[model samples]
Target: MKKLCSVMAGCAVLAMLPLTAFAYPIDVQKQLNGLSIDYNSYDTDNDIASIQVNNYGSTDAICRVVFNNGPESPRTRTIEVPAGKHKNATAKFTRTIIKMRINLTCTPK
Candidate 1:
């Protein structure tokens, strides 16, 4: 019984390892001009955030991405995506992020 209890405790500790990671919620606001635009947002790290923009329209596109973290100045990035291509925009913040907001705007080129 003593050995069983020790093994159970070890298992519990291992199981809890994955729970130590902090994952925050991400919110996105987008505006696209009659084009098919898809985006994915990620809280890549404690101070880093990224967004992936996918353009599925027949025409190339110019995209503007804005990343906002609480109490931090917003970061802006511009990218050009060809038809059926994808692009990534990333920003790093000075402080750890509790929540992330992304604004995406795309226009045909």
Candidate 2:
């Protein structure tokens, strides 16, 4: 019974490993032309990151999102956000990301 309990505890610890992982930091730089644009950045995975753009203005807008990871090429994603709508942009890097830097530029479409 003691051996079984020890095995169960080990299994529990292994299962909790995924939950112990914390997200990396994300930095966002934005240039919105007087539009009500809001954005949220996320560290999706070890080698992936994403941004969610929310447009609360009355006009449609075009947005460009760039994701940069250390020692890897920057990834750029261009998206259109309709009025009162939102969109998501994601990028995957070749290596595990320690920190993410994002540049966001939006203009009326």
Candidate 3:
């Protein structure tokens, strides 16, 4: 019985781990990290929250965004932006753009 309980506990912990992991292209990640990002503008047309991500660097870049509006108010998820010199993205919530975090995890090319 003790062995079974230990195994169950291990399984419970593993189940609690996040299973939603997105793997973007490696070459794109390298390109994105090499460039710098510039905040352009935000748009909220037709109840959709969208923002522009511009790469001010000399090369292209890849980036991901995470929206954090409020606790239990808007459940946002991680979304990858377009792989290019510049792109636009829409978040789950648009009421407050400050809560959004842009993660630029790019490797130097």
lDDT tens digits, residues 51-90, model 1?
A: 9999988999999998998798999999999999999999
lDDT of 1 at 5: 100
lDDT value, candidate 1, whole model: 0.92
lDDT of 2 by residue, 49-107 (tens): 99999999999999999899879889999999999999999999889899999999999
| Best candidate according to lDDT | 2
RMSD of each: 1.9, 2.6, 13.0
lDDT of the structure predicted as candidate 2: 0.94
Ranking by lDDT: 2, 1, 3
Number of backbone-clashing residue pairs for each candidate, in the order shown: 0, 0, 2
Give candidate 1 regions above 4 Å deviation. 2-6, 9-13
Q: Which whole-number lDDT from 0 to 100 does residue 18 have in model 2?
A: 75
TM-score of 1: 0.88
